[model samples]
Target: MESSTRTGFAKRRRSLQGPFLSEDNIDVQSDVYIWNSLLSGYAKSSMFNEALDVFRRLLNCPICVADSYTYPNVIKACGALGIEFHGRMIHGVVVKSGYVCDVVVASSLVGMYAKFNLFGDSRILALSLQNDVVLCKSLINVYFACKDHCSARLVSENNIDVQSDVYIWNSLLSGYAKSSMFNEALEVFRRLLNCPFCVADSYTYPNVIKACGALGREFHGRVIHSVVVKSEHVCDVVVASSLVGMYAKFNLLGDSVQVFDEMPERDVACWNAVMSCFYQSGEAEKALELFDRRF
Candidate 1:
């Protein structure tokens, strides 16, 4: 079986060459794989319109049936092009073909709907999944994007047993922060701290700190400071810069300046954070001083 698979792969690779080798030349048995490869190549190249054109051709082909790989690339193309009408039509295809039960297809559908701000449909599709964590996470993010925090919270609560992956947690936190639900975001952060295995990475802190800054919750920001310090991730430039920005926003100039001073290495964003803080605080002289020093 492995040797046969290798031979098939080698044949596919060879078929990738030459201009006049039409799609018609592909064996009927290999049509799904060939169409998928072509669709994927077109989607990756950002030729979404061309990918849709090929998808339409595939749908019209009498012998071909849309498979799992076919829908994801085409749905992604629809999302990229903001072609919600086409996306709905693809959903119809999925339903009629009984591919709606496929997890990957369902996830792609949820993402496509979400990209167009169609949260109602996205949520319905998400709930239909028997055990789809990825789709649920996508729905959470879409709900957050639509500013429907209640819906996002509901999804998270219901999916608590779904073994929240890092991406899912990040999406929930980011959604709460983006929606200005700083307290809820902080509560989630606190819960994360209790999970011994749930160590925060660089991506986690920045969004949480941004939420603190937006709400001017200086105490929360300070707690995050202590967390960063203890995690030994303070040396990370991204985390340090985010802390500086958060403190600066909350008018904690002393803490902001201290974080900046302690940063062993600084990037353009780090300098910009302090400069923006100085500008916002009406200390034009200090801002200018820092800008001059950096330049």
Candidate 2:
């Protein structure tokens, strides 16, 4: 009954908001809810700075009290901007407001801490919640961000459902690539190919191709090229660039040249890949020829 009343009140308040504000006669309590709504909307729309702006305004208004919904959005903005001090301030507010136990706000705090590479804090916050899949996923992402692949793998392996999660696979692939663990990245891709749990997408193909290039694994590169073609992502700029780079890195100039020529539209990256291929393969003249034609 109380929930229904609040919802109806919110609906009526939303309708009255513009008129009330225009008249500068909105009640203080309505102003708090309106600010919370604005802050949440801004954060959800990825307008982090604007969310922070509204947050600051809310802070200056003594009549407005920060609620559970308000803290998460504010913390999200702080996280997105990597503002640790502001996040900490919001955390303190959350604790005093007794909102630290709220799952949504807690998850946001965990995610924010993880974003800033505060792995220990993230871990502690994540563990406070039980049977929360969202929190577990955030914890997995935190480990990945920390480059603790062992811990990440452990978490992923322990979570039975995450095995079929494409985002988890993408995170692991990205983590491996970022850490220069090219061989491990390829291995993960190989596993991904065999698993019926998930299928490769544009994001997956490019990273795996990059790993193949780094390892000079021409055969693996060929296999991935076929997969890319079968996946019908051949024209994707990022995948195409990775293919060009992979072929070039293996000194397979002909295949690299063919891929470059086949691109329907060439970006600067494609051109750079073709030129770098020749340059890296000790074909300076060919590299210069391509460079000259690029003008």
Candidate 3:
């Protein structure tokens, strides 16, 4: 029975891995644990719709009643999707099922309400729960989203006792980039660079490079390129792609081509980045030649 449950969970997890999963792939015989595992895995992986699909399946299954473990994953998925109405619906279910007291479920609810800018609701829910780093980070993110930068900074500062990690810095960097605060993004990247213990990885390079691209700062971009080389993450496909894009944006087609050429394993995305560079630089013929070669 335990083995079957794990198999069912794996099957559901694999089904939800793609951009579009076929309905036929779902295992109708999956138990509550399997369904809950699917929901949890999918939500954590940012497969929000897939997580919701698992939740709906659980809701319909007579034998698969969602327990406390199930609510947190579904609630987080709802939050990530920014569907406040459905989030509230899930909240009602949580209250009715008496899972509201579960720390995981409560934290997810706080995050969900904060995601929708319903700070009042989030604060009320949060008050009943013990403060944790995850909840604190959620508030920081929500405040940042609401353009309360000062509050965001204050929250992060107040939580200084909680050691910061590269992930938090990356989050701040990406947030700045999204807000078109490229300079600030670079500043955050600089702060991250100065940290002795924290190391920038494949994920870090792309966002910083993206900020450099947006500013058209070739000097900074070159510096980042050197950093990527030093970090030995230059071969990472995402980093390579971002570097190609950064060079392309700066109208340095030659540099973009050089980066693309050096990539040992070129995916369709990397190929497209180089082709796009050529196309955007008024080299349609070259772009076509590359596309033909790719095919």
Highest lDDT against the true fold, candidate: 1
lDDT values for all models: 0.77, 0.77, 0.75
TM-score of each: 0.68, 0.62, 0.59
Q: What is the lDDT of candidate 3?
A: 0.75
- Tens-place lDDT digits, model 3, residues 162-252: 2255655666766677788889889878877877657887888888999999998999999999999999999999999999999999989
Candidate 2 residues 1-295, lDDT tens each?
6566555554654454355433355374446777887776666666688788777867776566777778888998999999999999888878888888776787678778878978777665655542455555555565666565665555555444666777767777887888898888888888888777778788888889989888878888898899899899999988998899889888888999999989888889889989988888889999999988889
How many clashes in each structure? 0, 0, 0
For model 1 the TM-score comes to: 0.68
TM-score-best of 1 and 3: 1
Off by over 4 Å in 2: 1-69, 72-108, 111-141, 158-161, 292-295
Candidate 3 at 73: error in angstroms? 10
Query: Which 10-residue window of candidate 3 scores lowest in summed lDDT?
Result: 154-163
Looking at model 3, residue 42 earns an lDDT score of 74
- Stretches of candidate 1 off by over 4 Å are 1-57, 60-62, 72-104, 111-121, 128-136, 146-148, 158-164, 195-197
After best superposition, candidate 1 residue 63: deviation in angstroms? 3.6
* Candidate 3's TM-score: 0.59
TM-score ranking of the models: 1, 2, 3
